[model samples]
Target: MKKEYMAFLCIVAFLCIAALLLTGCARTPEADIVTRKNTEALTDKAAGGTENRKSLAENRKQTPEHYSWKYNNDAETLQISADADILLPECEAVPMYRLSSGGFTQEQVTGLYDYLFQGRETYRVEEGGLTKSECEKQIVRLRKQLEELEQQEQGDGQGDDDWFPDDEREYLQGILDERLAMYGDLPEVSQDKKIAVDSTLMEQTGIDEREDGRTYEETTHSLECQTDEGDSLYVESGSVDTSEFSLLSYQRPGRYTYSSGIAVPVDPGNADEKKSENLPCTYQDARALADGAVQAAGITAEITQVELLEGLAENGEDGVSSERSGMYSAFQFQYTRTFEGISVATTASEYVNEEEFSLMWPYEKLRIVVSEVGIQEMEWEAPVSVVETVEKDVPVLSFADAAAVFEELTPLSYEGKIEKLSQGETDASMDIHVDAVRLELMRVKNDGSKREGLYVPAWVFYGTESSTVYTSDSGSAEETWSETEPTPWIVLAVNAVDGTVIDQVEGY
Candidate 1:
C-alpha cells in the first residue's frame, strides 16, 4: 500500500510540472517566436550546424544583372535616375585589406620597360635649352627693341604707358645688357649621347630614418629613347619606402605638355582642320592598348573614367573668340586598384590639412593618356602591398538604404553652391541628376595613422548638377541664366556599412 501511494504522488508531481510548462508556453505570438528561435539556435549549435552562416556566404556570391532605381523630391529640386549595371562586389560580405607602402620588383620594372620601349634603342639626353646662337639672336633682337623704344620715347615725348611702360623700358634694357655680357660666358649646349639603360641598376638615391624606427628609401632608374617618328620618350621608374611604393612614368615633351594637374598634347598647328577629322584611334582601340599595357605591368586595376583631350576656343579680354580647336588629341584614362574582383572608386578627393600639406601621404593612382603615337603619358603612384585581410566577410547595408542616405545628404553636399546661387538672383533653383551608382571599395584611413588604411565597401553616385538663376526687373522679362556641368561628376560617397556620408575632400 505504501509503494503504490508513493508511485501515485510521483505521477501527480510529474503531471503538475508538465501542466506548468504548457501554461507557460501559452504566450503571445511574439513570445512564442522568440522561444522557438532560441530553441532552434540551441538545437543548431548542439547539432554542429552553421546553416545561417553558409546561407549568408552563398548570398554574397550571387550578383544581380543590373541595378535600377528612380527618386524625385516633392519640390523637384533633386531627381535621381539610375539605370546602370552593378559594377561592384556582389557579395553580401566583403573583406577589408590592410595596405602598407609597396613598390615594384626588378622583374616587374624590366617587364614595364620591355613593354614600353621594346626593341628601340635608348639615349641619354642633356636638354639643350636655347642654343648659343639662339641666345645671340635673342640679345640682338632685344637690343634692337630697346633702340626702337628709345627712339619712340624721344620722337613721341610720351611715357608710352598704354603700350610699354617706363618700368618695362628699363627692364628690357637691363635684359639686353645682361644677355650681351653673358653671351661669351654661356656654356656650350650638351649633345644627346647614345647610352645603355641597365634596368638592374636601381641605385638608392635617398634614405630617411623616422623617429618611429621606420626607414624609407628612394631608389630610381631612368631610360630615354627616341620614337620611330623622331619624338623623344623619357621614362622614369622608381620605388620609395620599404615595401617599395613604386612609380613608372612616360613623357613626350615635344608631343605633350605635362603638369601636376594636366596632361595635354601641345596644340597642333592645324587644330582647326583636325577638328573635323576623327581621332588617331578609336576609343575602343585605345582602351585595348591601354589594357594590354596595364596587363603587361602586372597591375590589377579597373578603368574607372575616360576623357577625350580636346582643345577649347578661348575668349580673350578683347571680346574676340580664338580659333576653334580639334576633335581629340589623346584619350585620357583613369584606373583604380582592385582586390577580390572589386575595384576602388576614384571619387575621393585627397585630403591634406594646410599644415600637413608638405608632408601629406601619397595615394594610389594610375592615369594614362593615349595619343596617336601611342601611350603618350602614364602615372602610377604609390602602389600598395596587402598585409592581411581584416575581415573575411562584413555585412553591408542594401543599395536602397545607401541611396536613402545619399538623398538625405544631397542638399547638404551642395548647400554652399545653392546659397551662392541664391545671392544676386531673385529666383534660383538647383536640380541634381544622379545617373550612376556604383558599389566600390573606398580607402578609409586606419585609426590614428595616415600611413595605414583599410579598404571598405562604399556606394558612389555619379551624375550632373545644373543650377538656374533668374533676375527680375519688376517681372519685365525675367533674365534666366543656367549652367550645366558635364556628366559623370562624383556626386557623393556613402559608407555602406554604417550609412555615414564620406567627404571626398576630407576622406573620412
Candidate 2:
C-alpha cells in the first residue's frame, strides 16, 4: 500500500510539470507581440516631441532642408548630411576649424632660404655669387647692412654703414641698383581683369581605388568655362588638380585661358609608394622652373611674389585626391601678380609698401606643381587686352581716415572667424578680430561695359584675421596647430581721390 501511494505522488508531480511546460511563455507568440508593442510605444513616447524631435527642429533652424550642415546644440555636435541618393560609407568627419594663415610664414622662410643658399640648373652663380635671383640676395644683404647701421650712431663714411643716410639715398644706393636689372624703374602695377565662369558638368571625385605602389603619379584636368556674355572656353592641364577652381574675385567679361601640361616620374624604378620625398628643388630652382614653363607657354606677366602653398598629396591609401592629403607632402608654387611692365600707381612714397602688395592687384597669376619629376604641370591666366583711360588725379584720404571709411562701409560681424593676431599675445582666438589694417594705392581699370577702363587711383585695404587651430582626430588632422599662412581677412578698395568705394568682389 505504501509503495503504491509513493508511485501515485510521483505521477502527480510529472503531470504538473508537463502542464506548466505546455502553457509556458515560449509557446505563446502573443507575449512577444505584446512586449514589442509596449517597447514601440515607450520608444515613441520618449523620442516624440522630446530629444530627437526637438533636436531635429533645432537642426532644421540652423540648416534648412536644402542645406547639408546640421548642428545639435544640446549635444554640441555637427554633421554634414550628404545627398540623400549618394553614399560615402568610407568618408570621415572633417574638423570644423583650420588655422588661418596670413603674414610671412613657412612659404616665405622656405622660399627665401632655398633661393639664397641652393643653386638651380639655369640659375648660374656669378663671380660674386650673383645668380638670376640676385635681387632677393641683395635684399637679404641690405637687411643685414641696415641692421649694422642700426647698431651704430651715425651713417658716416668711417663705418661700413655709409650707403644711405636717408630714404631716398637708401632707395637709390641699395634697392634701386639691385632692382634695376630685374624690374627697370618703377615695376608695372597689375591691371584689373575679370573672368566669369558658370561651372557646368562638374564631376566630383568619388572614392577612388588607385594603385598603392606609386613611386610617381600623374593626373589631368579639363578646364571648362563660359563668360557672362556667352563665350565658351575649354582647356586641359596635366595634373588632376592642385586646388579646386574657385572664383576668388570676378569682374565680369574678363579673358582667362590655360595651357596643356606634362608630367614625369621622379624615379622610373623603385616600385615603391613609400613617402612623398621632397622634390629636390630649392626656391631658386623653383623660380627658374616656373619661369621656363610660363615663358614656353607665352605668358609674359611677371612673377612678383613666390609662395609655397600646401596642397593635397596622393596617399597610397583608399581616398580621393580632391578632399584628403596622404603620405606624400605635396606643394604648389603660387606666384602672385602685378602687371609686369605696365603696373602704375601714382602715390606718395610713404604709402608705397611692396611687401603687402597682392591685396590690391586683382589681376594675372600663375600656379605650378613642384615634384621630383620636375616642374611640368602649370596653370597660367592673364589679361588678353586692357584698354587704359586717363582720369583726373584727385587727392586721397589718410590711412586712418580710410580705415574709418572702410569700417563704415562693410557690415562685418566677427562671428566665427578667429580674432586677428594678438595686438599683444601669441595665441589667437576662434572668433574673428580685426587687428591690422593696410592701404594700397592702385590703378584700377574699367574693363566692364565701356572700351576705356579708368586709370583711376584707388585705396585698397588689407586686413589680417586671426585663426583657430584644429587638432581633432578628423580627416587628415594633426595633434598640433598647422603651419598656415596668416589670414588676410579684408580686401576693400576706397577711391583715393573721391572717397568712393570700388565695388569689385568685396571682402576677404
Candidate 3:
C-alpha cells in the first residue's frame, strides 16, 4: 500500500510541471503576435499612415531592384523608368518631383507635354522625340482615365467641374486650332499649262509636210542614171509653181544683232602727257630757277617806328623870343639805300638827285634819321645812336611799287579801341592816366566804318585800374578783370566811329 502511494505522488508532480510549461509557451506566442502587430502599425504610420500603405515585402515583390532609388555620376544624367516607385523625402517633394536631362529643364518638358495633350479634338501629336512623345502619349492615356473617373464621379455626385479654368481651356483650344491648321493637307497642282504645249504641238505637226506640199503639185525631185562601167553624170534641179509661192507662205531667216561698237585700245602715253599739262605749278618757280642761275644777290628794305616824344624843344606861346625847350615835337625821316653784293657797297639817299646818285644800285641798305628835338620829345624814342637793319630779297620793282603790290594782296584796314574814358566834372582835375591801348585788324564791311576785333597776347599786363574805371558815351563797353590779387585788366576792341564793341578778351 505504501509503495503505490509514492508512485502516484511522483505522477502528480510531473503532470503539474508539464501543465506550467504549456501555459508559458502559449503566453510567449500571444506576446509575440501583439508585438508584431504594434511594429507593423508603427511602420504604416511612418509611411504616411494611409490605407494604401505597402509593406517592405510587398514593395520588394512589386517593384524591381532597378526601379528603386539609384544615383548616377557619369553623363550627369538621372533616369527614372516607368516602373520606378521612388519615394522622396517630404522636404524634397516639390523640387525633386520632376525629371531633367540633356539641357532640358523640367519646366520645358511640362510645357511641351501641356501643349500636346490638354486640348480639343483638333489637337494631335504630328511628330516629336521619343521621350516627349511617350510622355504625351501617357498624358493622353491619363486624360482618358480621368474622363472615366469623371463620369463615375458625376454618377456619384462627386464631379469636380472646376478642374480646368476658362482661360486655360480657351488657350489650349486655340493652340489645337493653330496646330491643326499648320498641319493641313497640301493642295494639288493644276494641269492646265495654258493647257498642254505637247498636245498643241502634236495637233499642229499632225499633217505630213510632203503630203502638204504634194497638194500644191510642185514637189521638186532629182534623178541620176549611169552606165555599167563608164563615167557617171549627175544632175540637180528644183521647181516651184507660181500658185504655191504665195507671199504669206514665205518665211524670212533669223538674224543675230549685237552692240554697235568695238573696244578701242587706250594710249597711256597720251593720258600721261595730258595729266602733266594739267598739273598745278608753284608761284616761286621763277625764284627757284634764278636761285641756281644767279651767283650773288643783296636786298634792302625799310621799317618805320613811330613814338610819342616826351620832352622836346619848341617855340613858346609868344611865338618869338619867349622860347621853350623840352616840348613835344614831330620829325621828318631820311632814307638811304646801300648796295652790298660780290662787287661793292654803295649808299644812296632819297633826298639826293637821281643823276648824282645814279652810280648807286637801286637795291641798297637804307638808313633813317630824325631831328634831335623830335627824338627827345617822342615817348618811345631813346637817344638816337644806331638802328638795326633787316635784309630782304629785292624784286625788280621799286619800294613804293612793291608796297602797292603787297597792299593789293593784304587787307588795308586799321582797327583801334577806345581804351579809357573820363567824366569831365566842371573844374574837376582832368589829369587822366593814359593806358597803352592795343589795336588789331578785322574784316572790312560795305559801310566805311571799321570793325575792331581784339585778342590780348598770353601773359601780358592789360591795363591799370584807373584806365578800367572810366565812364564814357560809348555805344557798348565791356571790361574783364583777373580774379587774382593785383588783377590784370582787359579792354575790348571798340569801333571808334560808331563806338560798338566788336570783340573782347577775358582776363586770365
lDDT leader: 1
lDDT of model number 2: 0.32
Could you report the Cα RMSD, in angstroms, for every candidate shown? 15.7, 30.7, 63.1
* Order of models, best lDDT first: 1, 2, 3
lDDT of each structure? 0.57, 0.32, 0.22
Residue-level lDDT of model 2, residues 1-508, one tens digit each, is: 3454344345434543454466654332111111101212322232223211122123223322221211122322211111211111111210111111111122322342233223221111123333345455566666666666555435454454544446634754566466545544332433333443232222333342333432233233333443333323343222112122112111112111111111112221221233244545554555576665544434344442233332343333333334323233322444432232222221111121122211222333346654454543444332223222221122233333333444433322221122233223333333222332322324333322111133333444433323344444435544435322232223345543334455442211
lDDT of 3 by residue, 1-508 (tens): 3453344335434543455475655332111111101212222233242222232233324332222122222322111112222221112111100000111122322332222222212211223323433344444654555556556655754445665434454655565454444433422332221211110001011221332344223332222222222211121222112111111000111111111011111222332222212112221331222221111112221221111112222345322322322222222121221122111111111122133211111212222112221111101100011111111111111112212221221111100111112234111111111122222111111111111111111101122222123333356564432221111122122221111222211100
> Each model's TM-score, in the order given?
0.63, 0.32, 0.11
Model 1: pairs clashing at backbone N, Cα or C within 3 Å: 60-91, 60-92, 102-244, 102-245, 103-244
Candidate 1 overall Cα lDDT vs. reference? 0.57
Runs off by more than 4 Å, candidate 2: 1-277, 294-319, 322-331, 340-365, 381-384, 389-396, 407-455, 466-489, 506-508
The per-residue C-alpha lDDT of model 3 at residue 38 equals 22
Model 3 vs. true fold: TM: 0.11
Worst 10 residues of 2 by lDDT: 93-102
Window of ten residues with lowest summed lDDT in model 3: 376-385
Kindly indicate the candidate among 2 and 3 with the higher TM-score. 2
Report the C-alpha lDDT of model 1 over 1-508, residue by residue, as the tens digit. Answer: 3454344345434543454477755432211111111212222232222222222244345535465666665655545555656555645556656565445556666666677777666555556455567687788778778788778778865845577558778899888887777778676674444455444534456776655666667556544555544544444445322333355666643233323232232222333343224446666777887887788777688776666665334466333434335445667777787777777767423444233322234557777877766777777766666777766565554555555555545654465455555665466677776656777776655434334566666778877667888788764887898976543356777655444555544445
